[model samples]
Target: MRKTHLLGYAGFSGIFIFAISILLLHGRQPEISIRYDAMSYYVYGQLGWLLWAGLLGLGLGSLALAAGLWRIQKGAYARVGILCAGIWGTGLLIAAIFPTDPKGSWDQPPSTRGMIHFSAAIFAFIAITLAALFIAHAFIKDGHWKPVQKWIVPVTALTAISFILIMISIVSIFVSHGAPLYFGLTERLFFFMSLCWIGIASVGLLRSER
Candidate 1:
């Protein structure tokens, strides 16, 4: 199969894995809100294989998408954008390998493994956000994907803003010794926007090749 098709499959499958995973877990975790408790499912769910498999698929699929982008596109923006996606994929892989302590276990003293998971989560968020921003810039400058660029710029901005709100909420929670407001909503917004961007870009590239 052509590389573009391969990447398209990967991109589509990555989204599928994430969607299916959440759907499967929805009934199992009645108390956990997907908006705020997605990481909990990945980190602490009893259905370990399901979560791990989903994350693995996401990691591998992201890496494949990055490779496809790098292979098809030229210029510094494309290079840097794809590099960010690659690193984000690597981070997700590592996070899957090092699952964090269970939900409500944060009060316990941090373990080395837990620290690794936390670091990986942070890295993944930063890298994915950067990837979106860089790709938006690339699309604008390249002009070949102008329609995508038009939509991407707004999506990237919203994702970044949501990410910042999440970070702020995290800090507020720690410093104030209380729950920060809208934590789950902001996190979901960030990931949803970023992932949507990835899906759209992948589809656009696939269509362009046809």
Candidate 2:
């Protein structure tokens, strides 16, 4: 619970995720991604590095999140954990659309993004479960509050609503024709929401020090 330990561990995790995501994406992922074709190769060659960097940000953000959760109330941690898992897990559900198709043969390439997304979901789920256990430990915590209603209720609702959006895209992928891009804005939004939540949590944890 010491400020230095909380911040230090969280900060280290944040940096580790950020760095590894980048290295995995650029140092290795693009080569695997490029076997699709000349065009696909060109695109990956150019932007795969960038996407890797973005994933890096997500990883670091998660660390900050884990650290914050370690400090916050058990209920708050659970809320944030679900928020994170639901967000990142949605990415896997989206990416699942790939790894298939007539134009892109089965031999095309491998995408670690989906795997990475899956791992994040599992981690977030575990974190939340632990938070829940902590919640059951003797009840000195606040019972309920209106501000939680104003923020947690609304944000959780938004996350739930977004699930419908994800379902639509899933149906569309099976029912519709084609895609102009590797991914879509909706997937990005999922991660973005997760990032916003963790980033907010990190700030709150940091601020609590004042």
Candidate 3:
């Protein structure tokens, strides 16, 4: 019933939905290499609804968490961090609304919808990384979460760099006719790190209130 608890629940729900979506979709497309395929590709097949629900869950959960943070905290860092989280949530919704063009379609110039999806994906990556770093700094400045501050920097760096690599991969698609060899791996790494930071920061903030 408490606002902080709601944030924790949102964090957990986001993590759970995304994890389950990946688990269920992973083996469903054996031909698609998890190492090279984008998770968005799952939105094209028999169990596509799972990914849709998962993305919606992530978007709603992020907004809910941001709202909860806004209610419980006050400061520039907290405000900026929550605002970034909100942007990230909105990006997820945009991505869901505009799914990427199919695999073969990747070669051709992106359709209007596909370009929108790509733009949303880039926005989501940047927003979430900023959210993570800003939130981590806020917690550290609070003076009670030194432990969190310790690990957050490295995680934030990895997330940011991974995102950059992903962007490079996308650029490679336009330049040389294909994504980078490590595109999928870098993408997954970024997603997982960002999720870990969100979950940990949400729980950490909740516990700090207690």
lDDT of 2 by residue, 119-162 (tens): 54445434433322333221223332222323443444444444
lDDT scores in order: 0.74, 0.41, 0.78
Give Cα distance to truth, residue 116, candidate 2, Å: 7.6
Superposition error at 11 for model 1 (Å): 1.2
Please tell me which predicted candidate would have the highest lDDT against the true structure: 3
Model 3, span 1-210: residue lDDT tens: 677777768877987898788788876866656677788888888688888888888888888778877776688887898899899988988898888888656667888988998899889988998887777667666653555667777777777787788777767776777755666777888888878777766666566566
Best by TM-score: 3
Of 2 and 3, the candidate ahead on lDDT is 3
Query: Measured by TM-score, how close is model 1 to the native structure?
Result: 0.88
Colliding pairs, model 3: none
Segments of candidate 3 deviating more than 4 angstroms: 143-149
lDDT of 1 by residue, 101-120 (tens): 66655456767877897788
Q: How many residue pairs clash in all the candidates, one count each? A: 0, 1, 0
- The lDDT, on a scale of 0 to 1, for candidate 1 is 0.74
- Whose lDDT is higher: candidate 1's or candidate 2's? 1
